[model samples]
Target: MPRKFKVTVNNVDYDVDVLEIGAGSPQAMPSYTPIAAQIAPISSVPAAAMVAAAPSAKTGPAGAGDQCAQMGGVVVNIPVKQGHSVNEGDVVVELEAMKMKVPVIADRSGQVARILVAVGDGVENGQALLTIA
Candidate 1:
């Protein structure tokens, strides 16, 4: 049997056709997505968002408001605070996910803005771990 599925890529939707050994008509054709593009990570951070901003918009950087959260355990320690500066790979969330402590690193270098979770609080996957400004 053949199946049809819809996929969204780069803000564009696509209707794809499949052939199950003997499916589809001879006139069927595969379409290429014009807007969808492949992304490669060559470095720890992308080069575009790191560029300096104009004097008006106060967005210090893209990673400035990013955070790392605990996976499955309680938030044990929080070494950094609001206004504190950090570099990439810095330990931001010290959590015990599976009978072991894990260190969630800072996704990028920036100043801390907000601490969303608290100590001794149990956290789930993708929870707000920290905030950078």
Candidate 2:
């Protein structure tokens, strides 16, 4: 609450809290300090759910079970659903992020035929994770 500087010359107006203004002298405009460490310490939650918990949502179809959203994460673990019968690279589903997990394999063999996203949802990056007919 201590730092006032608002000077205007000509019509006459001056209010200085004094902080040494001399180099060229002309300091009078300072009032906006809420720099609580450059903002980022309130954290009651809600920063858009911490950016939607990072890269989450948008998967449903690429090969076996169609598992396509190649990069987004959160499903964490699906194992295999639909008609179940993978082969290519198997792994089916298992994505996470920050904590890192991401699997989503099986790019060839078939049978799963349709599962999309479950266990916890939230996928996106490339979306379409399931459908190996």
All candidates: TM-score: 0.49, 0.28
Report the number of the highest-TM-score candidate: 1
Clashing residue pairs in candidate 1 (N, C-alpha, C atoms within 3 angstroms): 64-132
**Largest lDDT belongs to which candidate?**
2
> Which digits, one per residue and each the tens of the lDDT, describe model 1 over residues 1-133?
6689899999999998775653476546666655535544547555675564322322233243667453557888898987899998888779986678988898789898888778898876666677876
Q: Where does the lowest 10-residue lDDT sum fall in candidate 1? A: 53-62
Instruction: Give each model's whole-structure lDDT.
Output: 0.72, 0.73
Model 1 accuracy (lDDT, Cα): 0.72
Query: What is the RMSD, in Å, between candidate 2 and the native fold over all Cα?
Result: 12.7
Instruction: Judge candidate 2 against the unseen true structure and give its global Cα lDDT, from 0 to 1.
Output: 0.73
lDDT of 2 at 53: 73
* TM-score, cand. 1 vs. native: 0.49
